[model samples]
Target: MAQLLACFRRRGGATASAPDEAAEDQQQAAPGPVLVELFSSQGCATSPEADAVAARLAQDSTGEGAVVVLGFHVDYWDYRGWKDPFASSAWTVRQKAYVEALRLDTLFTPQVVVQGRAHCVGTEQDALAQAVRDAPRYPAPAMKVTFQRPNPTTLQASFTGSLRSRVEGPGGASVLVALYENGLVTDCGRGENKGKSLLNDHVVRRLEKVAAVREGASARKTVSGTVQFPLWDGFRATRCGLALFVQNAALQVLGVQHFDLPDNV
Candidate 1:
């Protein structure tokens, strides 16, 4: 029987580190799907344009290199007359981690982080495109994921495989999984976006660290976990998808894989 590695929950306060360029260059040379993360808030007037850009990127599939888009709604703008229903403080912390890793000054709306390597204004299509184009490529994590619905409002996922990239030094690597929704429409009644109809896709609803690869850990291991969803937030298998990525201690994304929720889940 294969040994199931113990997985731990993610904790706050870990200092973020910059990417290691030398180690990154030694990974697989093949180009893999690019991860484009958009940080925006519905309460911000400028977010709609960035959301539209993300939607366009999500629909683009003609290019040889694939792109994976995830929209993270931050809660900082909630105080501006109207609270964004999709916003979460966790996403804000995640963005701040990137800010610290990239040595940025502060947070801003409609920001895009590409492959966890670079950031730019999300609404600036040219800059976003350039960042994606310049981002380093790596082979996909050789893993297989299976989903199970142990109960309504809860999702159980089991993953097994080897992380194709190498991990050296103190903090090891992290296996992060995110649940995102598509085709969402919101009507803003107040705030800067008052009376505007906002369309958002690839909105990240839940994020979890299912497994951790400690320093000197084996290359291949099995891990699983359950993600609980709020009853108020509807879960439609057809409208939701999952994205998993292997990120090293320096905050560089080593590999990525995406999966659509099975209709029956």
Candidate 2:
């Protein structure tokens, strides 16, 4: 087992750039907590209950700041009933990759992957909230990420931050770049869920870990990267947005935010 470090912030606070402010205009925005990622689909009737539970968790930022919630709409359920408008193959691939990387046997919907190392049923609120509270508080990552939005579909991000190993720990970490989208809608047509309309927030469309931060004795460090949107059928690039976060190798979330969409994807 990898040794977990202490890099968590005592307080829950995040800074946003101009693009973040713009994205906030569309809907309510919050910062990172124990990042609870829900892999769900609009076509699954069981998802709404899980989604509701996740949404409530997202709202609770009091005890441990704010619980950052991200919904990754997966396309695996599309053939059952209604094809979820937000579902994407890329999102599905990301989930599968995590399974392989983490060495898991099975994967399913309404699955809540906490931080990156923990998994729980999405509808289980009590266990979920408690897990968030118990999560380790590792030191922040090596980069502080911020986004610049020239338009509604394009985003330019800057990562200038530092990561410190725990009092006596490993000297290296991985920084993940994830593009989170919010304010999504989907109509249920065929799967386990049919004839139902749905609204989603903080949904991750694409997730790619762009870099790994090597901890050093230095006081500060930095890295840079960019995420571009891909055009999909019935999915307009405008209503969608992005978020970038840097996490350690143990999958502990350190930094996160909603990236403003530039004019062009």
Question: On residues 146-189, what C-alpha lDDT tens digit does candidate 2 reach at each position?
Answer: 44456555444555544333222264555555565556666656
Give the alpha-carbon lDDT of every model. Answer: 0.74, 0.58
**TM-score for each prediction?**
0.83, 0.70
- Model 2 reaches what TM-score against the true structure? 0.70
Q: What is the lDDT of residue 95 in candidate 2?
A: 78
Which residue runs of candidate 2 sit more than 4 Å off their true CA positions? 1-32, 100-103, 139-153, 164-172, 208-210, 215-219, 230-242, 248-265
Q: RMSDs, each prediction?
A: 9.5, 8.6
lDDT of 1 by residue, 1-265 (tens): 2111101011122211112336534433445567889999999999999999877766663233467789999999999998998999999999999999999999999899998889999899989888878887665555556666677767777776566556544798888888889889999999999999889989998888868887655444444444444423666877877778878787887677677666666
